[model samples]
Target: MSDLAISVRGLTKVFGGRRVVDGFDMDVPKGAIYGFLGPNGSGKTTTIRMMCGLLTPEAGDGTCLGFDILRQSQEIKGRVGYMTQRFSLYEDLTIRENLDFIGRMYRMKDRGARVDRALVDLGLAERAGQLAGSLSGGWKQRLSLAACMLHEPELLMLDEPTAGVDPKARRDFWDEIRRLSARGVTVLVSTHYMDEAVQCDFIAYIAYGRKLISGTPKDIPRLVGLQTWVVEAGEVGTLEAALKADPDVAQVARFGAMLHVSGTDEARLEAVRQRHPGQWQKLDGGLEEAFIWLMSGAQDNFAGPAARGGA
Candidate 1:
């Protein structure tokens, strides 16, 4: 078997004459937790759908789980488990009922055993009889994950699975994701949360239907070539204004009481630091800074009078 679980090139998708996803390329290795990130309408979801064979690409060729994405969608779908941004399980059904139904759809030989195991594994055994509709957002998320894993698919594709959930619940969900990854199940997840993005083994940032950057978390900031200085002062708003006016500072973001000032030119940034008063600590920029820097250069496809809700 190939080391890569998914490989695609020149993937494109159009809606209303706008290229929602344009000439995309991606490679997801087996057992990797890949983070797919982009701004709203940047085609993150569209690209994922095409990769999983749920949506056909206008122009592209790829293999998912060694199955031809265009010619063997059914084969690809069978080996992949998909969880959408929204909770999609039958709300009227009990937790156990939902799992059983999914197992039936997959025609699993150990349907009953799998449902029981899923409920137990996801900490839903006690609430097995509870209606899915009555569960909280976190519980519903847990149920969705449980349902997705019911078929024991080789790959798990989750779209913002932690969105709107409590912090603790989000942490718990990621713990489960890591456990699955440790068990050699490849995971492809989309999330806007930087905390979650940091946990990914690989990351790809897309914008305006094009890829801005992709690499390990540590390498992303370096690749963007941003030099950042953390500014600690009694009045950050005033300093923020000052930095924004300076031509050298490319980006200034307020983080709590401090400000993170960054720019592409290291010498210019250092010069700005010497001019500023208060505490200034120079350090490497992180994922958040790189994300903002990459996003600033992208042109939104929906901007102007020709806007469409394509994404």
Candidate 2:
């Protein structure tokens, strides 16, 4: 078997004469947890669909799980599990019933045994008889994951699986993902949450269907070449406007009480700081700062007046 679980290159997809994803490429090794990070409407979903063979790319060449993506889509589908952004299961059914139904769909040899194992594996054995509709957001997410894994797929594609889930629940979900990876299951997950992105083995940042950067989280900051500083003071709003007006401040965002200011040119950023001495304090620029700077530098493909609702 190939070391790569997914390999695609020159992938392009267009809708309404506008490129939603353009010349995309990615390589994911087996058992690796790859994070796909981007703003909403940045083509992250489109790219994932193409990689998983759910939607054909307008132009691309690739393989998923060693199957030709263009010709062996069916084979790829069977070996991969996809969890959509929304809750897609029958809420009226009990948790156990849902797993049983999925097992039957896969035509597993022992559907009952598979369901029993799934219940235990996801910590849902005690609540097996409870209606899925009655479960909390976190519990519902767990049920969705259980359904996806019932067939024991080699790769899992999760799209914002933890959105709206509590902090503890999100942490637990990631723990489960890591545990699965240890057992040699490859995962490709898309998320806007920075905390979640930090958990992945590698991360790819995409915008308007174009891949901007892909590497470990630590490497991405260096690749973007951003110099960031945190500013905290009494008149933060005033300082923010002043910083935004400066040519050197490429990006400025408020995180609680402090404003994070960043720029690609370190020398220019320092010049701006010197000009506004004592107005802002300098501090280390973290991953969030780098991401903001990177995103600010990207041209939004959906920026036109007509693309407002479409994006």
Candidate 3:
């Protein structure tokens, strides 16, 4: 447990007679970038809040950054940085003003120096005078991260930090996170992007408030027990319908110009694939395919197949 940045078990939360998070357990190693992933309302944010001491779990005990989540919540909160899904900082405030404000909120003696360092660290030194409202989504994300880092917390709990940002900005944001992890800062970030989820040292997928899968990215594919094949045709109009008719083809989706067909039953899937005609290529299972298959099997509490959106 000493090597863990977050250790929690039986973490549960409820609201309005609905269980939002149920019997969730997790262990995130220190200095590791841990990805918390799930569809919307899968309890990723609620679990983060519980681990960070912002919201108490109705049925759980844990320690975050060496502090008890229930008893030492204040201490845990003081040492951790949390960024919400939305831009919560003052939009009208300039980058410098925002950092200064956060620094003052932490009541640090060298507030100016810390803010300056944060600006330099986040590449906002030059744009420190620009208003956050006028900045792009990526820039606003950087500001929010800078705000979270003002006090130099040991853990960063970012909930979908790259939601509306561009690809380049998202990449840059993740690059900085890697730098922080290299400096021995433990980061727990929740994101729906498979590209971003792949960047973490460890990742966990939750569905309907239950943890579906958790492990290193390399191992998660194996956990799902999937076999895959790629099929490409000038127009796979009939081929797709044919594959769907077979029960062995558990999952099928168009991947760009081609279609990625997957199933847990490799023998049956391969047999079906052999019978089909197209540019057939046997492929290894992937994270995106695994997640899609997993989500399809899980029940969505709030809405139907088309109504819900996530990972």
Candidate 4:
């Protein structure tokens, strides 16, 4: 029994002459909420699939839940729950019926009791008789999560599970995830939302099929060595454009009336600030600022696979 739920090295996947998931390595501790963050087409989903045994990696050696990912895929599958990005249950069936069917598929004994317990645990007991297709986005998400947990797998992998749901629904989903984690279920969740990323025990930021950074959200900013300043003033649009045009300003983004200006070069950033002293106010760097700077420094995999390296 290893402490790591997932341990892999040199995992690679190529498609149509493009290295969708380049040589990647990961070590996820047991019962931890590991958030996988990246932009679109950054290979987040592909990497998750390989790790969970849904897709075989072109090159890699690892174990998932103490089972060999390559040689014991079927055994691994039985002990892992995978929630896809979209709702994948039988929408035409009632919530209870859908859950019962899943229990039967897994061939679990006491199917009725298991279904009942799952509904109660996921707060779907009230909606048990409702057709899944008629439920709102939030309810649908809850039902999907319940179905995934019916088998009670030790490891859970969720890919963008909160995508189109409302804010309240997203918050509810995260609450359930945290509860599961507390009960000793390891979770690997892929998300683009920074708010959700903060909730994870640790995060791995991937870009162009390679992981650029991995650490606690608080440690990521410090690791990147970024200096940021928040600018507040009238006519923020003018200030944002001015900062974006300057090479000294690595990144500039507007948040309501305030603009966030950041750069890796401390001296150059100071020079920019000196020139626009009256137009902007300076403040400390934030997680979002650090993430933007990290992304800017990463090389896009447009040319080909990333050369083997470490950050």
Best by TM-score: 1
Model 1 ranges off by over 4 Å:
300-311
Candidate 4 regions with alpha-carbon error over 4 angstroms: 278-285, 299-311
Q: Write the per-residue lDDT of candidate 1 for residues 43-67, one digit (tens) a residue.
A: 8888888887889889989899999
Q: What TM-score, over all chains together, does every model reach?
A: 0.96, 0.91, 0.93, 0.92
Per-candidate Cα lDDT values, in order, are 0.88, 0.85, 0.86, 0.85
Judged by whole-model lDDT over C-alpha atoms, candidate 2 comes out at 0.85
Candidate 1 lDDT: 0.88
| Candidate 3: pairs in clash | none
Runs of candidate 2 exceeding 4 Å displacement: 278-285, 300-310
RMSD of each: 1.9, 2.4, 2.9, 3.3
Question: Each model's number of backbone clashes?
Answer: 0, 0, 0, 0
Say which prediction, candidate 2 or candidate 3, comes out ahead on TM-score.
Answer: 3
Better of 2 and 3 by lDDT: 3
Tell me the tens digit of each residue's lDDT in model 2 across 1-311.
49999999899988888788889989999999999998788898888888788888889889999998888888888889999999988889988888888887777898898899888887889989999999999989988998998889999999999999999999999999999999999999999888888889999998767898999988777788877787777887888889889988888889888888888888898898787665556554267777776676664544654246365
Worst 10 residues of 4 by lDDT: 302-311
Q: In model 2, what lDDT does residue 196 have?
A: 85
Candidate 1: pairs in clash = none
For residues 1-311, write the lDDT of model 4, one tens digit per residue.
Answer: 48999999889988766677888999999999999988777899999888878898888788898888888988888888889888899889999999999898888898899999988887778889988899898888888888889899899999999999999999999999999999999999999888999899999998888888899888887787777788787877887888889988878878998888887787998899887765555554377777776666665343333533322
